[model samples]
Target: MATIFQKCKAKGDPCRRSRCGHSWTVRYREPGGRSGSQREKNFPTKREAQDYGIKAENDKREGKYLDPSAGKILVRDYAREWLSRRSIKETTRKNYKNFFENHLIPRLGSKMLCNVMSSDIEKMCQGMCEAGLSRRTVYQSNMVPLRSLFRSAVAEKRISESPVALASLPRLKTKRVDDKSLPGGEAVGAIASAMRGDLAVSVWLMAGCGLRIGEVLALRDTDIVEGAMRLRRQFVRVKRDGVWKAELSPLKAREEGEWRDVPVPSLVEHALRHHLRNHGVGADGYILHAHHGGHVLDSNYRTEFRSAVIKAGFAGESWTAHTLRHFFASSAIAGGLSLLEVSRWLGHATIQITADIYGHLTPDAGARMRSVMDGVLATTNVSRDDS
Candidate 1:
């Protein structure tokens, strides 16, 4: 950090009918170092110049000074640089690009980063929602990029403060769209029963063990060891040249590529064995195979699942393959499984993630409260004595 210097320019003589003009200039180095552009500001009086020079010097010493012109740089230039520096997955990169192009760049690309305020951001978010954008898209695509951009600007001393932290953000509901539409325990069994062959086995795995569809598709005969099945990776689809292609990747866990075992239920084991004995599997030994023994895509499962629900006497129920996963975790919690245990079985990144989804579905909250209240009243003996 360097100190600011005050330079005063004084007029030596006045014209016959005019007064002499005088001004003060405060000169300072740009925030980074001496290599930066030369900076100077002028004031009408020496006292004002000295005050600002002192403040600038102190701010520079404390690392709070930002160049007034630094923020004039367009957001597009900084955002593009920010995106280029990040190492991310292909699908994630594609999504971020869409967010930048579709949501943010259209509205804020030309604007300078420092000129934007939290109110502008709040209005942008409200406008997106008002324009019928989903809450998920608003936060993930628009708000996240905005936050990251301003955060970087502050770190680089391009701006003195972040607009994101300046105010409260608009409400964005975090619940999944299908949270209300997931099937109950009875519906789970019926759908599993309606499926046949590989679909049947896959549904049972989702319903009984809560394995994700990607993990189910990636399950191999080689993964089974000592009556436990390992989930180390998932089948992901990445786009190339505007076409999605299947690729195997690590699970989206706290530790990337995390592997965990799920204890096999007798029913799931029976269903898996039945499919294995009759149909075998793809060359990869995948338990769930697409037509012609390839990876089973979501498109393949959705068509079959739609028919299965109708066939299972659940014609009016709206259910997807993911619904089975939800039902299994909720049912497990209702049936006396601890959240910590169920979280492990479902391979959740944290117990909090498991509780966030199925926490309200747990039956013990009301039941245990009832038991505790009843016991407390019984021990008090107040009801009998008053009677």
Candidate 2:
């Protein structure tokens, strides 16, 4: 147990003021029995000092004790150590570096780790919005890192609690993402016909199979089955030491290596067969080619796709590579596939995610029920007038 004492001044001759203000001091032996007493002084009241000492002792007993001095480390230095200890994906690391350099360090880096509070983070979020950052960017790039670092700090015993634990976060912006611009089945035919060679097959796969552009670019000869394709990997462009290059990475999910056999539609199969017959497999074993050894490069693919869109009489940016994937998803839903089944086919991490993005496409049975009940339960009488 800790004890508090009134530290009265010694018998001084000059300018004495009420026993030198009667400073209260709480003193206790270190809980681990390895050192002398830990003194907490300068408290104005004995109750306050006692409260402090009791909380400290309780924390020590619970194995949650943090040295008060340790939290005095600057946020910037601690953040560096925190980042060094993390092994994250290239894209994730890129975002972390961007947030650390632009948002976190400039604002909170000089402050002590203990001084960062929930309200301060809220203000930062509001300030970022006022400074013209999008709501999603403010929440994702600012508030997220602040909350995350504080969590790490608490786990490392540098601070007692995460400040943002109770903070009301900004709402992440989500527009209704159902693919409406796609003009049904004819849209895919028009777009794919405008492109030449493997570029044509790429379009068919993306539109017909719900394949990501990166995944389409990364496909190999071994991935093709009779009427299905094994989606095992994706081609990603990542920056290291300020240089960017392509890398083959596993599919994105909780289980990174998960591969799904997506059924290839007849049109997609025809395109793939045509390409394989014309180009065969490249020296590097890519099933398609762009007339430049092996698979098509990302920049070249985008360039040709833009030209194709222009030729097909559509705005270059309106129907993107991802738009085709959305087209595939919407078409599948319209063809009577269940939401859960579509989510698995889409390779989403959760059904909730698939629902959030594509749930608008599903018809509302509850609305139909409300309509039927309204007619059956109507109180107003309908008159048959014969004048």
Candidate 3:
């Protein structure tokens, strides 16, 4: 139970102007705490204190009582604990830490979790936008972590509710995939032809098989199974002992032992065979490796890819190594493959993602429906004449 009393420096003294001030204070033990442990909060008026006392009692009876002091934790401190408690991939954790240090901490670190309001988050998002960050960066990259943190705080009872739940977020502007956005077959061939003999096969693996850059580097000779490439892992950059190194990690969004098999076209297979015959396999049967015969880093491949792109007369073009993946997706959609199949091959989290980007490329559904209806009506007319 809560009780209201006038605050005074002297014990049992009447309310008066003193060092502690003549404000009304509500004193009560937490709903679930042991006896003799009390919590107090000051209010400017006796009625305010009494109202707070009644609300506390009501909350306690309803089992929704929250200790007001628990939310006093600084966001920086709480974020540290929250990061430590999460079970996430190392690369993902690194990204989170970097984002927190660079973006979130600088803006909201000093504020207590309970003190952070939706307007504060909105202001932070607006600041990110004003700094020239892209809409996708502001909404997906920047807001996701903060929103998750506040949601976790609410779940843990550290705060009454998440301030980010109502915060304004940037609108994500999506670009549709089409022949114009994706490179054509000749463009891919030209890029491949311009690459070095040893690394040229990387282009085909991406363009023909829809492999991510990391997946391309992680490919191994032994992973070829029954005329298909079994994607077991990906080469990812991880920070180990204060140094970032290229390491083989599990496939993104997949379990440790889970693997997907992508059929290798004749072009990709021939390229792989030729690459193995000349460059040979690196340590642990990896098809591609750095100069030191270890796993290839992103910089190593990016530099070569850029040089190849320029040599292929696309230096001023926006085409990237990942564009080959888009090229593959575009080709798959054009070849009458279902969105679900394309999504699986592209390793997308869901078919909806594939549809969102490439659904416009689907064959004219209205025309196909019209053709079917025409055939149906013709058959119905013939049956009526026979009757």
Candidate 4:
């Protein structure tokens, strides 16, 4: 229950005994408070205070009560606290920190968490778009953290609900036509040839073995078996003591000590041998290492990749390093590998994810199935005499 009253400020002076402000205060028992503790808020008018009291009681009964005082914290403060408490992967945590500090906090940091509304979220997204961020980036990378933050705030009772759930974000645009096409062998060869001899093997590993950039960067000779390579770790940039450094982390979407064995095709094996004979390995045994020491930094690798792309006459194209992974997937599908086989080879969390991304590559699947059925039926020899 809530009670509204005018404060009796009579302890100061005789003149103040009969004089009081027009403000009214609503005193109410706090929801989920220990020992039946009370909280209060001042209103400019009696009706407003009465309305607030009624709403507070109703909200408490409905289990939607939000402490007004708790919501006063700024977004920047709460986001830092939220980030510190998150139990996500180190790579993902680093990425989230980048997004929060550079994007989310810059836009919404000064605003109070409770005062933020759905419009603010929409506006923030619009601003990102206007500032040259792609629609996919704004929708996926940017919104994910914001949505998670507000959702956490709601769960923690800092806000009544998440504004992100109410905001109207547009659907992401479909993949561009160019994104559907993977590089041919010639293009791959050209790009690799344009790269320095020591770094050329990365192109082959990614294109021939479906290895991710991080996985390739972290590969070692010890992990290579008789016919396959074990993927157990990756090199990713992580922030430690306010400085960024490349660190080895567990494989994505897999538990610690869990590893997958991907077959090293002849092309990849030959390239790996050539790289080893020429450049040797780092102190940590990483195949790809810096000229001075340590594993190759991700930024330096991408920069070299871009330079190679330009030198190979692939400038102004959408051929990012991940494009090699797509080429590998397409080649595997074309070579009659089942979706499940390709999914496992590509280290996907699920076969459906592989199918969703590369399903179109199997356009001749129905024809091949028909041909197999025809062959099986032809061998059956269904003569009338046999019947």
> Which predicted model would earn the best lDDT?
4
- Against the unseen true structure, what C-alpha lDDT does each candidate score? 0.76, 0.77, 0.85, 0.86
Instruction: Give RMSD (Å) of candidate 4 vs. truth.
Output: 7.3
Tell me the deviation in Å of residue 218 in model 4: 1.1
Higher-TM-score candidate of 1 and 2: 2
Candidate 1 wrong stretches, greater than 4 Å: 1-24, 30-38, 43-55, 58-72, 176-186, 253-256, 344-352, 363-387
lDDT of 1 by residue, 1-387 (tens): 333333322335433333234566777776667686677888876678888888887887787878887788887777788888976666666777887777677777898987888887777777788899987778655666677778889998888889877856755544632446777667777887888656788888888888887788888878876667888888878877887777787776634557888888887788888988988888788878876888887666778888999998978887778877787787788788888889998888788777777777667477889898998888665645555
Error of 1 at 222 (Å): 2.5
Which of 2 and 4 is ahead in TM-score?
2
Candidate 1 structure, TM-score to reference: 0.79
For TM-score, candidate 3 versus 4, the one ahead is 3
For candidate 4, the 10 contiguous residues with the lowest summed lDDT are 10-19
Tens digits of per-residue lDDT, candidate 4, 9-51, equal 4224323533355577899987765565688899888899999
Error of 3 at 177 (Å): 3.2
Q: TM-score ranking from best to worst?
A: 2, 3, 1, 4
